[model samples]
Target chain A: MPAVVIGLADDPDQLSQDLQSPYPILPVGALFSASERQHLSDQYTPVEFAAACKPRFLNAVFARYPTVETLLYADPNVLFLHSTQPILDRLRNQTLLLTPYLLQAPGDTGPGKKAWPDEKHLQNIGLYNADFLAFTRSTETTQLLSWWQSRAETRAYIDFCKGLCTDQIWLMHAPVFFGGITIVHDPSWHVALWNLPQRQLHQRETTWQLADNGQPVLFVNMKGLFNPDEGFFPHQTRLNPAKRPDVMALLQAYRQQVAAKELAALTAIRPAYGMKPLLPVVRGWRRTATTALTALNKWVDTIYLPALPR
Target chain B: MTLAFTICSINYLAQARTLGDSLRRTNPDYQYVIGLVDKLSTANLPADLVPDYPMLEVDKIGIPDFQAMCDRYDITELNTAVKPFFIDYFYKNRPEATAVIYFDPDIIVFQPLTELNKALETNSLILTPHTCSPTPDWERPNELHHLNTGVFNLGFIGLRTDKIARAFVDWWKERLVYECRIDLCEGLFVDQHWVNFAPAYYQNVCIDKYLGYNVAYWNLHERQFSQRPDGTWLINETDELRFFHYSGYNPFRPDDISKYQTRYTFSQRSDVKPLFDLYCRELLANANEQYTKYPCVYIKPPTIKRYQRVRKAIKLPINRLISLLQHR
Candidate 1:
């Protein structure tokens, strides 16, 4: 279980030194060659530059550990509460695995639940959660990763008009086009705020149990939880902590760890190689004013006034 | 085995060609056929460039007084009037066919029709409603319009060679032969409005509300579209977009995906835009510009002589007054 730490900070060395894990922490900058860095820099935004590194990092890991049959790529934000042996056992027969946001559509009855993460919301973001992805080293896995890498290199933004939400949106079709896919419906595998309404995490003796069924909770992806004092928010805005008291202890522990990480110290860090960084205020202002117009122009070129149907 | 066909005249050959091409790409196992409601006259050069699929002209379908029926009904009526006859003809003639499907010439299939085929395995008849869910936008042509025009969009229908389908064909044929007209006053809208009672009248009828099937402008508000990484399309997050009905889409105005409904536009409702571009290219590639000029042999392109125009102008107000009085 060699974990690769992707440093989007100005000084990846300092960031890598701060991390302590049981597995080896391989810094991404040390892994990439000079020419590879130049090639990646020419094509990615700062955020995309970091997001696109996941596949390259995994490819490197696969090369370094040829004996390893299954390689898992989880976002840094995910926290594990149990052993990963079950996930490994499940991945033995499958080439790739993903988890859907919700096993069934969430009804409009719960507090703050009816409004969003609705049918259309899931359609825009993606059907499958990319927080935890595991792949076995095989031809199909290689092809799938390559396909995802190609899409990420070009358009890995949160633009709903282009049907993009980083690399997550593209996985919606992985099952249909890539022969078939194993969508992990196990509630305990990768839980998150989006699916919290349906999945309740109760701390049972020794381990956390999924309240709906007594399946042991493996991990919870703290995607949208924010420390109010720190003032950083996730993309989603509707996660109410008052509704989820059962998971409060887990959330507090993660928040303390987040605070300990001194994320504010590295807030100004930009990727060493990528497009110029625009100020967040300017980016927001320009994005709000230009998204619709740019969408129209892109539609005309690629879809509306296309030379061929795409 | 299943046989599918679209009923059209020479003028609709381009659309028919596009439909045939899509069927070959998506659902190639089924035997595709077309029912032409016109004679292969000498001047119509489209007869030379007919699509590769087997075509059954009106006369070959063995209907009595077919030419007279063609002469009486206008283009819309004629195309619809012959639907049941074609269904009956295929089921009776093609011994190998277990089921028969119908698609409007303007529709293009996108995915394998396993859902429809699966429905046919148990059910004898299938119909798609103008909408499965009520539109939130309260405007003209709401549920009432669908009720008035037809509850079922006759553009697509599936029939198995079972007792119910055979009975349905016999019953539908009897009404269509005489009653297939666009007379709103008589509560008639070709062959579509009559199928509103199919669920009640038949033993094994399925109203297929699959989100992906029979998607069109009227139902666009209900269905949302997203593209997979591999460029395949899905509808409402789960189901694959099986087929789209390009009803009232004008190739000339390529910007507008549909001419009939105003509920969707290119800018706001751009999910269906890719579908429009693909359908347009298919239609144009199938010789849309050239085929549009070749009029149907049976329905004469109405020639407006100056004297007739003058006479109609003189009598227009009197006809309107009489129509208003009769309605009153």
Candidate 2:
């Protein structure tokens, strides 16, 4: 499979610098018009703007490589411990391949089965791991992508009440909405801290297995397991080092790989588009004011109204 | 077999009776048990104080030196501390019991616990958080208050007789026996705060976020009240009103919904007026006046003046500092 690294570059020189990487690098600004970019920026938060751009990114990828039948979108944080050949083989027949949270089931001491993201977490966030998703280009997939883009473009913030979380929560109902959607339950796929309680890691030589006899871990989602500035070996506060020392190597390797990328210089670059969150003090003041007003309204209704004559 | 129980001292017997009546009307099939945290006395010259349901005194639940436990804890703390002991008693002794559901004495059941029963089929421990949805901007008992007090409302809990359930009961009992105080600063709010970790540690734990499950003043901002064509109360328009928890409510002051919750009143939330009115009638009919007259055998009844004096004494220095800060 041909590798492609896509991102929006504010500076043309920065895009050239990124092009030095082995993978074919493409600037997102080249794909969309300035007007389209402005519209997207007006519609979502910085975090959400990046998510809403995925459908268009995939469309661009498909247009560039017309022979490419399937497109896999993995978050920058995910590390490929194994090849994507197996996932691609399955995607040949299926329109969509999504990873199940594997939270709804009861505990069973079996190979390649772990329940990290417990049922409560799934209920809170969503069922699908939007970090790792595969979509085979089809009429149904095209329509699904359009529907997802439409939702994400408008309502892609982290608000659960509005049923929005970038693009993840929207995919929760994707199985019902789109046909030929297969939920990949294999534990080797999308292994992260949420399911660590169940998915035991045993590394033999360089290969990581779920249990004594499990499939090779396709990828390890080191989403929050590293802090380049702090130089912490394992950044997950939830995971105890004394207990699961097996993950020490896995996390250490991930940290080294991320550091090797030497993308620290780009960290200070502010987003050219989308909303920045309000200052802490400003947000706190707004909350307090809203609360006080509400209380005043209720107090008037309870105390002042009772004395009123009919 | 399934058993439903509530833990309370003599003061809450009237409320327990009302709860029993609700269960009798709504879910008569389930065995109702009252875990009395205080000893009973027949000194009161009035109608029968006890309800028709079986009463299990806290002492009989096999807590070693039960009197000492009672002495250490105040009325509220004592009532809450004895819950795990009673739950363990039912699960250990009664092998026939498939599940045990607990409700606060103040909660009045409207609809059968069908959703809870359905949840228990798969889950070992089920809990309902104070508010499943976000509460609109309010002064007190907001999301932060719930965070400080507890995530789950221990007033309504369902536990299936399983390994994790039994483990939770043991763990909770250990915590409650020592630290079931209502001291928010100390990170203790009876048994409620400890169970916030239930979903974290235990397996097959289900958080039943059903709108109707435990409707109270705290969650009223999100769950709207309405009535069905058949006259059955509904929550959020669609959800059947399973139970209404009169947590801080007093039947004596029917106009004031709850002393603790200043969020709503009879004049403000007129929809819940009929429900509170029905509750008041039931409580009064259950001889609330006479029942409250009797004191718990374990401890002397506190006088209103003394209680106020003690509270003021505790708050005097804090109040002085606040005034000083304002003046500065």
Candidate 3:
């Protein structure tokens, strides 16, 4: 198999020097028109624009490597801990492969004990995690790629109120709209913060396995684990170092591996696209102040004004 | 054997009766029952006002927190919340019933459900999306609304009595116990939004795109109705109309298409006018006026309910503050 990194680069030489990796870089502007790039950048934040570029990247890959029978795309944060033979075998004859966020229902353990990434969270973000998608060369796959590209170009923005979470939520319609969709139910694939409560990780002699049934762990999505701002997924508060020492150990190892690379140089090189339209995130004191003001407004209307006059 | 049922309070008995009459005329082989959310004993209905179908009161299903559910939800929410419980009841009590289908009380059957029954034979669950194509305009209930509400409409769900179907119902029942509400901010719109996971979670689930399956106000953009010389209805001149869901139509406002929609009017879309006219006449003949007078025994008065909700809203901020301070 071959590997390539698709990114936005203002100075390709500087990017190549920063990342001393073997994988060649494919600029995002090479795939889309100038007008299309402007529309996407103006409409969405950097995170959403990156997500919307998935279909375009895949289309470029298929066009470049016409003889390549199957293609697998994984997010940069995902780390492989085991062999990919099993996953490749599963995608041998399938047109598209999708992995759900959770294979089992996050049960109500008790009052203080609650499940993270419950049905409500999944309903908002999406049913399938868009971090990993595998497709084989087929007519159905081509059709899906075209449909997804059209939707991603226009409607790729993070608005949970409108049930839009970048390009993820739109995959909910793929199984219904397209043909030959296989939902991978193996718990070992694409393990992440959203499903940690159900998947317990344990290290074996050489590879990692699920603690309960000893299923081999293929790869783990280190999405929010490495982000200093997010600190292990903002939505997840149920899991901590005290609760699961094994998960913490895994994160520690992943952090060490990332530290070994030229992380500072890579982080310094900013992308050339999607610089405007900042993400709508209210952090630190701003969040606290916003909450305080909302509470104060409600308090005055309900308590103070009611007790006054006439 | 197959069991088809609809859940409604007494106030909607006329609509329920009309639905039952349609099923009886179209598909007589199926057993039709009225799952009453209202207590007939408390209402003491006259003989003429009562429906002729077998009436099964909701309280008889033995929902453990039935009283608590009534306290928490209003009429529309309460009626929809108990849908899965009714399916579970028939699954356990009716041993001979191999398939169970649910239609909202406002829907009328137009043709024999031959395709539906055939699909349910092999598939564990059958679901119909709100519309196969995109909505024409940004009307009241468009694609965004569908996303906030749900992708698949729960007005009609067909389940074959099997393990996967049982698991789906069990999960749905648990979620609807407390989280079933119309709060758009919390990503909930009653029981409809939750079934968006049916196809994703369960096996052998069929996302049936048959334009004939669920024809309603939300899907009118893709479907246009026409009557054949043989008195059968056809959609888009190709697919036969299986059922028409009169979701928001009222007998009093017979001229309007549906109170929930603003995209089309009866005059603008003359094709669907005859269907609405037929439904209005049937509802009136079934004592829609007399049935509308009776109130549901479980629902509290509007003023008291509003006051309770207001009190909760008022306390929400204070409760949050206290919790915040305690955590700090």
Candidate 4:
């Protein structure tokens, strides 16, 4: 399988040289109309913009490689620990394949239960992880991609209040809208922070398996591994690095690989698109003050101040 | 054998009767039962008001925490929350019932459920999306609303009495025990939102997109109803009008299409006027005026519930502070 990087770049040559990779870099700007690009850039954050570009990227890939039987989209942060042949094999009957965030329900007994991503969280974010998607060249796949593209173009923003979570939540309708969608329950596939509570990683000689079930770790999503500030995806407290030394070691190795790949310099090359002004990060005293004020406001609103009989 | 049922309090008995009457007329072979959330014994209804159909009270079913559920949930929430429990009751008791179908009390079947029966023959569970196509405008009950509520409408759920369907029901029952709420921020809307995971979680789950299956206010964007010379209704001049879910429709407010929808009025959707008119007459004939007077025995007074909610909200911040300090 050939790997392709879909990115928006001012100078493709500079980006290519910075990575020094064999994989071709497909420019995202050329795929859509100027108005569409403008709308996407205006509405979406850089992270959201990248996620929203998935369908268009896949559509472009299919158009480029017409004879390509199967195309799998994995986030740039993903590290493949095993072959993707099992996923591809599923595509023989299934048109579109999606990996759910958690194969097994989170445990209810332990202290981790409170911190673990519950069904509500899954419902909010999405049942299926948007990081990995497999598409076979079929009518159903075409319908899914087109439908996803339209939704991603407009509604791919991180708004949990309105039940929008950047291209992921929309896949909830994929099975209903487009038939032949197989929700791959294979525990090995697309192991990530959300599912880390249930899945225990262990080394078996050369291969890594989930210690509880002994399922091979096909691929691990390395999101937030490189960023110390984020610490394995923001707002996620389930993963305690003090425990799970196996996962820590794997993440450490992934970090070293990312470091070697000049992650700092490459990430510094700002995309020409989605130049929306970022929200200012609240830190230290400001964060504490904001939290306190919000709490106070809620408290005040909740305070029972009933009017006396007039 | 197929068993079709609807859950409703005594207040909605008129609607349930209308639904039962429609099913009897259309799909006569299928056994229709009214799953009453309100107690018939407590209401002490006259013989005239008692429905012709077999009525199963919620208490009859051995729900472990039945009283607790009634205390927590409102009328609508409690009615919807016990849906899976009814299904489970039938699954265990009704041995002859091969397929079990649930419809909201507010729905009326038009044609025979031939396609549905056929679908249920193979599929473990059959679900109908709230709308097959996109809503034309950002109207009330639009895509975002559907997303907030649920992708599939729980007004109609068809289940084949298989291991998978039983498992699905069991799983659904567990969730609806406490979590079957209309809380959008919590990503729940009664029993409906949880079924969004049905097709994904369970096997042989069919998302039946048949235009005729679940015609309602939300899906009126895609479906238009018209009666043929032969007296059978057709949706979009193609598929037979299998059923119409009169969700948010009130008989008293006859002119309004549905209170929940602002997308279309009777004037705009004259094509669907006859259907609503028919439903209104059917409901009235079934003693709608008398039934609406009966209050559900389960639901508590709103003032007490409101006070409790306010007290919880007041405690929330203080509780959070205490937990934070303890953790530190």
The prediction achieving the highest lDDT against the true structure is 3
Instruction: Name the lDDT value of residue A38 in candidate 3.
Output: 80
RMSD in Å for model 3: 4.5
The residue-by-residue lDDT of candidate 4 on B213-233, one tens digit each, is: 888999888887778899888
What overall lDDT goes with each candidate model?
A: 0.71, 0.71, 0.82, 0.81
Clashing pairs in 2: A116-A194, A116-A195, A117-A194, A117-A195
The 10-residue segment with the lowest total lDDT in model 4 chain A: A226-235
Tens-digit lDDT track of model 1 for B245-300: 99889989988767677676789878879889988888888888887876777785
For all candidates, the clash counts are: 0, 4, 0, 0
lDDT, candidate 4, residue B153?
91
DockQ of the two-chain complex in candidate 4: 0.27
Most DockQ-accurate candidate: 3
* TM-score of model number 2, chain B: 0.89
Question: What tier of docking accuracy does candidate 1 attain?
Answer: incorrect
CAPRI quality band, candidate 4: acceptable
- Model 2 has a DockQ score of 0.04
Better of 2 and 3 by TM-score: 3
lDDT per residue for candidate 2 within A1-310, as digits (tens), equals 5466655524345443443566766665776798977877776666677777776677678778888788888877777878889889889878898875443243331135333332323433455678888989898888788767766666566654433456665665565345677777577888876566558888878888888567798887776455421111122234563577877778887878767877676666666766644222122444445446545544433332222254
Q: What DockQ does each listed candidate score?
A: 0.01, 0.04, 0.28, 0.27
Task: Extract clashing residue pairs from model 1.
Answer: none
Worst 10 residues of 2 chain A by lDDT: A228-237
